[model samples]
Target: MFDVNARIGHWPYRPVGTVDDLLKNMDALGISCACVSSLDAIHFLNPQDGNDSLARAIAPHRDRLVPLAVVRPEFAGWQDDLTRCLESHGMRGVVLYPNYHLYDLDDPEATELGARCSEAQIPVFVQVGLEDARRQFGRTIVPDVSLESVGAFGREHPSLKLVALGLKFGQPDQLRQPLPKNFYFDTSNYERLGDLEFAVSHFGVDRILFGTCAPLFHPRANADKLRCADLTAEQREAIGQGNARALFGL
Candidate 1:
């Protein structure tokens, strides 16, 4: 199976293991491949450093680990960083952290970056939430990027391929209007009963991708959600791996 959401690097609040450990966990969960980003990139002064670290670490396992560069559009030299990430690092996609990076989705820099990625035909993964708000550290709490904002961003950039990670089962429904056809979501924070079925029925099966917010959350738990969901074999296969394969051209 292909995991659309996974991370490698240090998470200061938790014990996020190395790439080897990530591989072992994926193997244990019967996950064949995963799209990974750098956790360090979220908090780094120069996020490209974290992207570089991820590129080097995943070099030997490129076949199994697809790298997604973390880009802070608000930062200076971000245009060059985006170019290097796509050309030099050979990243399949880019992950955005508007919450941690302190920018709204409608910001001009974000709009420019989105337009560029759309032109490049690369998917842009937006991290909606990294940790549950209730459990966040008191002093360093980071709010989630609102789904309304995400919907707005999708409306503005209709051609951009967008995937929102770390959203709960019912969060997307909170949007009053429909998101763009190119918008997608990962199944990591979905936990309620019938959540997967709800997502499929609400968003269509093609838009749902299997994701394990691994090394931060247990990979097995997320995998079990897919295994236990009341979906047909074809539907399950599509969400588990087929969708990701088609989306990322794996």
Candidate 2:
């Protein structure tokens, strides 16, 4: 299975550390690969240094760990950073942390970055927050990015493949009303027994990807969630790995 959302590096608030541990954990759970980003990139003012760290760390394990570059579009000359990530690091996609970067989705720079990614046909992952709201760091009180704003971004870039992370509150009815066809959701935030089944029945199985939210949250819990979900073998295969493979060409 390929995890669409996972991270490597030290998380200050928690004791989670090392990409080696993440690899071992994924192995134990039968997860063959993970699309990972730098946890350091999440908080850094300029994400390029963090991206460099991630590239160096994953250089030897490129087959198992795919690097997703974090780009804070609010910073000046951010487009060049994105270019370097694709050209130098061989990144498969880019993730945005609007809450951490202190920018709204409606900001002009955000749209420009989206357009650029769309033109390049690169996948875009937008994380509302890295940590749970109730247990967030005292220094940084991050808020969830609005689902409405996500819909707007998706509409603006109709062909771009967008994934919304850390979202726990949208019903299928509400999501389908505005979200475009290219928008997908990862399962890291899904904790309930019937959530996956409900989402599949209402919103299509192709739109869901298995995610563990590893190191911050247990990987086994999500693996078991997929293991026990009421889905056919084909559905299980799709959500567990097929969707991610198709979306990111894994």
Candidate 3:
């Protein structure tokens, strides 16, 4: 399986463990590859530092772990950081946290980043929410990224590959249709019994990717969700890894 949403590094509220632990969890779950981003990057003053750390940590395990740079386009020199991540560090794609970064999706910087990623032909993973709203710390509450903004951004850059991670069960229905062909969603945070089946029917099998949201949520939970979903063998394979392989050119 190719996990499209996974993270390494610290989470303030809990111990997220190390890369070795993640690899072990993946091994147990039969997940061959995972697109991992830095949890530290979300709140970093210079997010590139987190990207750099991730690049180094994943360098030795490039065969199994695909690094995704966490980029905050609002920061100065972000262009240089992105260029280096793609060209120098060999990151497969980027993950954006608009809510934590405190930037609107329609801002010039965000637009420029989307355009650039489109031009580069790399997928951009947009995190909808890191934690459940009710569970968020009152002292450091970060609202979820607006689904409207996500849909609007995808419409603006129809050529870009946009993956929305951590979307709740009912959230996809809120996006205006017809949904962009290039836009996709992961299987993380969909806890309802029929969520996977609903996603397959609503978003199409090709648009759904297997994601564990690991270290924050157990890898087995989502894997079991996929296992129990009412899908054909082909549809199951597509979501498990085939879709991600096609999207990321793996």
lDDT of 2 by residue, 167-246 (tens): 67453345547458998988888666598898898779998999988878888988998999989999999999999999
Query: How would you order the candidates by lDDT, starting with the best?
Result: 3, 1, 2
Over 1-250, each residue of candidate 3 has an lDDT whose tens digit, in order, gives 9999998888878787789998998998889999999989987899999999988888889999988999998999999999999999988898999999999889999999999999999999999987987898888788889999999999999999999999888888889987888889998987686788888888789989999888899899988888888899999999999999999886
In model 2, the runs with Cα more than 4 Å from the true position are: 169-178
Q: Please, what are the lDDT tens digits per residue for candidate 1 over residues 124-222?
A: 999998898888878978988999999888878888889999888788786555657888888999779899998898889998989988778878888
Off by over 4 Å in 1: none
TM-score on alpha carbons, each prediction: 0.97, 0.96, 0.98
How many times do residue backbones clash in model 3?
Answer: 0
The true-versus-predicted C-alpha distance at residue 142 of model 2, in Å, is: 0.9
Q: Model 1: clashing residue pairs?
A: none
Flag the better candidate by lDDT, 2 or 3.
3
Q: Give the 10-residue window scoring lowest on summed lDDT in candidate 2.
A: 169-178
